[model samples]
Structure formats: C-alpha cells, structure tokens
Target: MGMRLWKDMQQIVGAGFTHDTGLPTWFEVAKATFLQETYQKWLLYKDDCVKMIETELVPQGGLFCNRTFDRYACWPDTPADSMVNISCPFYLPWFDKVSQGVVRRSCGPTGIWDEDDNGQVWRDKSQCEDELEVTAQELWLKQLMVSFRMLYTIGYSLSLSTLTMALIILLSFRKLHCTRNYIHANFFLSFILRAVSVIVKDTMLERHWGREIVKHSDVSDMLSHQAAIGCRIAQVMMQYCVLANHHWCFGEALYLYYVLIASVFIDNNKLLPYICVGWGMPVLFVVPWVVMKLLKENKECWAFNENMNYWWIIRCPILFASLINFMIFLRVIKVILSKLRASSNQRGYPDYKLRLAKATLTLIPLFGIHELIFIFATDEQTTGLLRYIKVFFTLFLNSFQGFIVAVLYCYANKEVRSELKRKSHNWRTEAVLMCCGQ
Candidate 1:
C-alpha cells in the first residue's frame, strides 16, 4: 500500500512540469494534480454508489416506510452525496452509516440508543462488548483521551482553587502571606491563564471550530500563518510560566534550607534576589523565542521538525532547572538530617513522622523523572503503547504535583492545618445554628 501510494504520488508529480520552474514547479504541479485526481476519483465512487442504490435498491413505496431497506439505501446516499459535494470521500461511508440511523444499541436503560434513540454508529456495544476487554490499541486511545481530560480538569480546578486560596490568604491572613506565598500567588495567576488557554484550545478542537475558522477565513495564507505564529508565542509564554513556577519552588526550598542551616554565614535577605532571578529568568528565555516565532512562518504549534534543532530550546533549560531543583532538595535533606543527628541528645527523635516527611521529599524527584520520560517519548516517531504510556504518565505525574504539595505541605504545616480546622468548625457551627433557628 505504501509503495503503491508513493508510485502514484511520483506519477502525479511527473505529469506536471513547466519549462521555467523545473523540478520545484513539477513538484507543485504534481501535488495539485494528485489532489485533483483524488477528489475526482472520490466523486466518481460516490456517484456510482448513489446510482446503484437509487436505481437498483430503492423500494417503489419510498424509503421511509421499511426502516431496514430505507436505512440501507439512505445510508450510502447521504454519505455519497455529502462526499461528492465536499470532494472528500474518506469520511463518506462512516458518515452515511451514522446518518442512516443504523445505531448500535448499548446495555443501558435506553438499550444503547439513549432516550432520544441517538446512537453512535462508530463503535457500538458489539465491537466493544466489554470495555475492559478492549484491545490494547483501543485502550491506549481511550487512555489518552482520559489523560487529556484529567489534565484539563485537574489543571483548571487547581489553578482556580490555588488562586482563590492565595488571594484569601494574602488579604485575610496578611501576616502569614510571606514572600513564598506572594510568589505562589503570582504563579497561580499565570497558571490560571494557562488553564484558560488550554480549555479554550480543547473546546475549539472538540467543536472543530479551529479547522472551520481556517477553512472559512478570507485572510491570505501568509496572514493566517502570521496569526498562528502569534498564538504560538502565547503558547510559549504559558510553557515559560509553568517552568518558572517549578524553578520558584526550588528557590523557595533552597531559601528555607539556607535559613535553617547556614543562617550565621549567609544573609537571609540575599535569598530574595534568588527568588527574583528564578521568576525573571524564564521571561528572558521566552522573549527571544517568542520574537523568533513571531518572525517565522507558523506551521504547527507543537509539532517539531526533525531537520530543525529546536529540541535544545526546551531541553537545555529544563535539564538545568531540574538539576538545580534536585540540588536544592538534596541540600534541604542534608541540613535536616544533620539537625536531626545533632539534636539526638535533646529529646524524643520523632522518628516515624520525620521518616515520613523525608520519604515525601524523596518522591519530589519522581516528578522530574517522569517528565523526562514524557519529553523523550513524545516525538514524531513514537507510536503504540509507549506513546500512550508517556502521555498518561506525564499528565498524571504533573497533575499529581499540585495535589502532593497540597497534601504534604498544607497538612504538615501547623498554620494551614489550624486554618482548615477552624474553617470546618465554623461551617459546622453555622449548620447547627441554622437548624436551631428553623
């Protein structure tokens, strides 16, 4: 099939050559010829099928009476007609079947057709008898969809929740809203923007609006490309925000470690500069990339060219950032361990709780490790289970970070724990008061 397609492509190109442009002209001519030929063939096929049904199979009583025959005849006609008009026959058969009311029943109360009798003909209960028993390929696709949904939902929820929490803490608990929380608040704002962008992109893709917008546009192709480039710039900014936030977390950890272990040697005030650098560096890295993207023709936002050496643009900083985070984490661990050892003579060790905290800290590196797997596995060449695994792990791990931080830090911190307890007590007290009044 591949070789035949290649030969057909070559023949198409060979037939369209002009004297002036030579090979390049021939290539362009060939591409146009191939598209035209393909379209014509699709139209011919549809016409043949439609002619067959209308002439041979259509009942004299009309198509609507006998549901079975009517469905059979109408199925091919609808798709065939649509394909003929659109000049895209690839989806004709599928759409025809779907449009003809050949629904696959489900096992639900509506018997898979639903209350409105609107059943999806693509994959019915028979094909996917037991969803759990689905083929690995099917499961992988389903899992990918699930992962996408999970990331979209979790990212959006966390962005909103975190931002709200940060704002409340900053405004209400002013004394508790220190530098780290201030940085976190700004990061959450950026995260909210990122989440909104993701939701918009996903919604557009789901509705096919993105493609429709392009198809229906009257703008020149070059102008369309320029607009795409601008969107890409915005996308890079979102990525920068995420990376910078991770770096900021590392800086926070480092500052905390220094204050605990090296307070006598280092000025605590100096840590503020490190925090500023962590946040500012990502902007510096992204500005040039955004400018270059604006100047370049936009083809795709995420697809990378094998011939282009753009991998380093993301990989280098990610590697450096991850390394720095690891180093900071290690420093914290070393200091904590040293303090625990030195204070052995003071009182009870709090061994169990301390062990648990250390274990949690150790798990932080897993985030970066899984992210690396995601980075390497998501390339043009990746396929099958590996690709799905990478996607699932990446989405799950990245999202898990926010939850982990919330659980470990918020639960462990005396102040946050107290605040949450107080809030819960207040809610209960309000409920009791309302009941008594009633």
Candidate 2:
C-alpha cells in the first residue's frame, strides 16, 4: 500500500518534485500550495477510514469471501453467493450527508466480490449524496439564470442598435449642438459603452471563468494566467461602465431640473460639469474597491462580493444618485403639473390627460423613477413566485434601460423628429434639383 501510494504520488507530481524544477510564477506557487494541502488532507482521511475499518468482522462460515478495501470504503468478508451491507463511509470528502445509511455489496458464488458491468468491484450508496443531488430548486435556479441571461442579451443588443441611431441623430446635425443636446449625446454614449461592456463581460466570463462549475476536474485548467487577468479586467470594466451609466442617467435628471428651475437656456460651458460627474466620478470608488479586492479578496476572478462593505462602494453611489433623482423628479413634477393646470385646463380635461400621460412616460426614464421598483427587493430573502417576478422585472429594467432612455429623450423628442424630417426634405429637394439640372 505504501509503495503504491508513493508511486502514485510520483506519477501525480511528475517533475514538480524533481531538483531541477526552477522558480515558479505566483499562480504556479499557489497551485502547488493547493495540491499540497489537498493531498495531505486526503492522506489523513484515508488513515482515519483505515483505522475505523480494522474492527470490521471477518467471514466465519466456509466458502466465504475475504475482506477488501477500495481506498474509499472498506468491505468486510461475507459468505459466498450472498450480499452484505455496511454503514456508509463517512470519510468521503465529496459527500456531506450523514453516515446512517447502509451500502450493499455482493459476494459472488466463487467467493469473490461481485464485479460490475465494467468488471470491477461495485457498491450501491445512491441514497447517501446530499451534496451531489440536484434538487428541484437548484434546477429551477439554473433555468432562471439561463433565462435571465437570454433576456439581458436581447435587451442589451436592442439598446445598442437604438442608442446608436439616437446618438447619430444627436451628433450628425450641427444645429443640435446645445448644452442640453450635448448632455443627451453623452447619456447615449454612456449607455452604448455600458451595453458593449456588459456583452463582452458575459462572453468573457462564460469562456474564461468557466460557465459551469464542474465536478472532479483536473488541475490543468486551474491556473491560466491570461484567463484570470482577462476575466477580472472584464469585471472591472463592467463595473466602471455601470457606474458611469448610472451617473449619466443622473446627469440627465440634473440637467432637466436645472433647466426647469432656471427657466433659461444653459450655456455650453455648463456641459463640462455634467461630463465630469458622468465620466470621471466612478474612478474614485472603483479604484478603492479594486485595491481592496487585490489586497484582501483576490480569488474567484474578483467576481463575488462576499464583503458587503466593499460591494456598497459601488451600490451606494448608484443608490444616492437614484434618491437624488427621485427628489428632483418630485420638484419637477410639481412644476410640470402647475404648468399643465395653468395652460391645458382651458383646452379641456381629455387633452390634459393625454399630455399628463406623455409627461409621465418621459419622466419615468428621464429621472430613473422606474428603478425604485426594485430598490427594496432583497434577492436573497425572496422565494417562490414573487422571487421569479422580481428577478424577471429587475432583469427587464436593467436590460432595456438604454432603449427606454433613448425613446424618451431622443427618438420620441419633438426636436429630434423635426430635425430628421427637415433633413429628409432638404435631401429630397437637393436630389430633385440635381436630377433636373442633369
């Protein structure tokens, strides 16, 4: 047994234990530490199992099979042509269930352990895998995650297309170069960049970080220096873009609030403050989060936020922006309602209702009031049907945000529509004149 283990260790370690092995990289050193701790713990477990198996009874009757150990569980001697049952092994590292069940192994008539279809000793303990069984809840969660990914993918793709067209309209015409439109252009660009970043992050995680957790996998895929850095960088970029995107949304509301309160045209010079808030502010928080992660919790591709304080570094800013936007919306709504009541009441209630609905539609995305729907939802405590609804709605809101903003601000704006119409009419007239002259 000792010789066999030593030979197996040599085979497993290969040239790793040899004297000629040079200095390894940080990843390789970490890999070596993991392997060493794993093997040492495994050896200790094997010893404990062997010590417990020593007291098992031997076969008493004639024509009986001898006792055997299969490195995982020890089988006691049993009478020929019969089955034996023993307590399930507790030392299996992969199994976490209680060791109360019995495992049955057969002794052949020829006084040998019965061979399985693969011609090897077999034992049945299917009832003992608490950690291995995929429960209905787990299956449901997996399906839900897949569906959410699909939903977000579609949403981001649509947003990308619509936002691109909106941005082109904002930029192509020189007349649309006011402070407000420039702010609109920045908002569109932020969402466009965010959509692209999200798509790339998802792809990189699936490919580089392993889409699914595998069982009993080998160490060959454990330490890829490139994939590790790539996925972490992707995560960082996604976070930065997310912060920038949210800040830009807040910038939209800020500009709107300013315009409403000042009741005057904003100077192009005022655009710089909005740009700084939208593009530059995320760096302050993201840098600290990244530094803490690198120094404290660097594992798992910097994907998990096991530390809530660290996670709040990103969440707090977005929440603060949302809260401020909500307050601004309340004031803006007061102003809007006052104006509507003063101007549209003489036009009749039906026309007033139509204008109010239009204003509500525009304000929801503009002020990010729609996001307050999910603010109180804690995904961890949710269960059953409500959880599904919340998750789906949250994904829906996140995925289609760019599209909603583009619709409310650019595609649905009167100025944008008029500009497009004028441009089209001018191009058609120019084409007619050239044709006539030719």
Best by lDDT: 2
Which clashing pairs does model 1 show? 106-112
Candidates in order, TM-scores: namely: 0.56, 0.71
What tens digits encode model 1's per-residue C-alpha lDDT throughout 1-438?
223323323333223222121111122333334434543554465466566666766444322321111111223222111111112223222333334333232222221211233422321212211122456866665455655665647755774575556455544654556655555455444445545554444332222212211221211232245444544544565667666755656565556656766668776654467656567777766665555554552343432333334545655677776666566666766666676766763776657457747754644742243454554443455666676565556555655555444444444557766776787898999999999999
How well does model 1 score by local distance difference test? Answer: 0.47
**For residues 266-383, could you state the per-residue lDDT of candidate 2 as single tens digits?**
6535788898999999999899999999887776456655576787888889889999999998888888888888787676665766787788777887777877887766544567
Model 1: number of clashes? 1
Which portions of model 2 miss their true places by more than 4 Å? 1-94, 97-142, 211-227, 263-269, 345-350, 379-386
lDDT of 1 at 278: 62
